[model samples]
Every structure is written in structure tokens, then in C-alpha cells.
Target: MPQPPADAPALAADYFQGYSVVGLLAALGVLFVAVAFGAGRLLRPVAPTPEKLMTYECGVDPVGEGWAHTQVRYYVYAFLYVIFAVDSIFLFPWATVFAAPGYGATTLVEMFVFLGFLTVGLLYAYKKGVLEWT
Candidate 1:
């Protein structure tokens, strides 16, 4: 069997050289990040007073421990907002596809199915009194 051509070895060497270059750049990036973090640590002043350590709420002194009981209604409202927001997000893409040919009927049917699921979720929330504010 004939030995591989000289250009073949040259190409392999070039590939390995490219790998080393990438490795070197990655190492340099990590080194620079570490040096920056170390410089910030060394140059930055360390100042921690009681006032700074205390929890601040709208510039008012915290009266009690940080832990406090929160109403569950707020969470429910947030979840409902998220559900509707995502539904709206889906509408934009669906609108784009709805304008395209060959996707109208199928997309419309699928969208109704998706809306049905959303309606079911909303109905469940309503029956559970999650929609009520008081």
C-alpha cells in the first residue's frame, strides 16, 4: 500500500492546529474572567454596616422577620395572567400561519382544540373560585 500523500498529513496538522487555537482562546477567556473578578475583589471596598445589612422595603424599616404570610389570590391572578399571556403569544404565530396557504383549515382546527383546553382550564379555575378576588 502506498503511503498517504504529504498534503494529507498537512491537512491533519492544520486541523489539530485549529483545535489548539480554539483551546487557547477559550483558556484566555477564562483567564481574563478570573483576573477581572480577582481585580474587582481586591480593588473594591468592603463596607458592611448594620443599616446596610437590614432588609429594606420601600425605604421603610422592616418591622418583623422577613418571612410573612402572603395571600394565595395574588398567585392565582399571576397564574391566570400567565395562561392568557401565553395564549396571546400563540395567537401571533398562528396568525402568520393562518395567512399562509395549505395551513388554514388544519391550523384553525388545531387552534380550536388548543382553545378548548384553555377553556377547560379556565372553567376549572372558575369552579374552584380562583377567579374571585375576595
Candidate 2:
């Protein structure tokens, strides 16, 4: 395929022209949201009272302080699991790409680099004792 001119101005102009419809649609989406919000604010009834102002949870009246202490380990464990899960998901597509004729070497190197990053993250988590279960 023939390449376009590498000049910054020319490249930017071409890029904008190529994506003009996308930009226009994005702008329109933003405008639609703004108009919808503006209309909602103008039309909605505001009759604030004590009952309405109070925090409601699943039709049950909130009791005690809203703030509660949560264990940080639970979140760390969940985040670590999510990272591994997503990385495993990435491997399936890479496996297919690795089997393909022209992409094997490139894909293999890329996969190693990706695995190296995941190894570093896992090592960091292990060092922090996040992997240890109580």
C-alpha cells in the first residue's frame, strides 16, 4: 500500500480527515448527553425533604455509621486474581497467532515479554506477602 506524506501538518490533516466522521459522532454523543442532562434538570420536580435526603439501601433504612472498615487483603487478592485471569485470556489469542505461519517468531517474542511483565508483577506480590493465605 502507498504511504501518505510524513509531514506533521499533512499527516495530522489526513488523520483528522480519516477520523472526521468518528470525531463528529463523538461530539454529537457528548452534545446529546449534555442536552439530555439540561432538559432533565429543567423538567424534574425538586421537593426535597428529610426522608428523601436520607441514604436509602435496598428499601431498608440505613442504621449506624455509613463508614465501615474493610480488609485490604481481600481487595489485593481479588486484584491479583483479576490480573492473572486477564493475562490467561490474552494467551489464547496469542496461541493462535503463534501457530500462524508468518507471525510465529514475532508473536513468541511478544508473548515472552508479556509473560516477563506478569512474572515481575507476581514476584512483587509474593515479596509483599499478598499470596499468603491466612
Q: Candidate 2: deviation at residue 80, Å?
A: 0.9
Off by over 4 Å in 1: 1-36
Q: Report the C-alpha displacement of residue 11, candidate 1, in angstroms.
A: 12
What is the C-alpha local distance difference test score of each model? Answer: 0.95, 0.93
Q: What is the alpha-carbon RMSD of candidate 1 to the true structure?
A: 4.8
lDDT of 2 by residue, 9-55 (tens): 88788778969989899999999999999999999999999999999
Clashing pairs in 1: none
Question: Across residues 62-124, which tens digit of lDDT does each residue of candidate 1 receive?
Answer: 997889999989998998999899899999999999999999999999999999999999999
Model 2 TM: 0.69
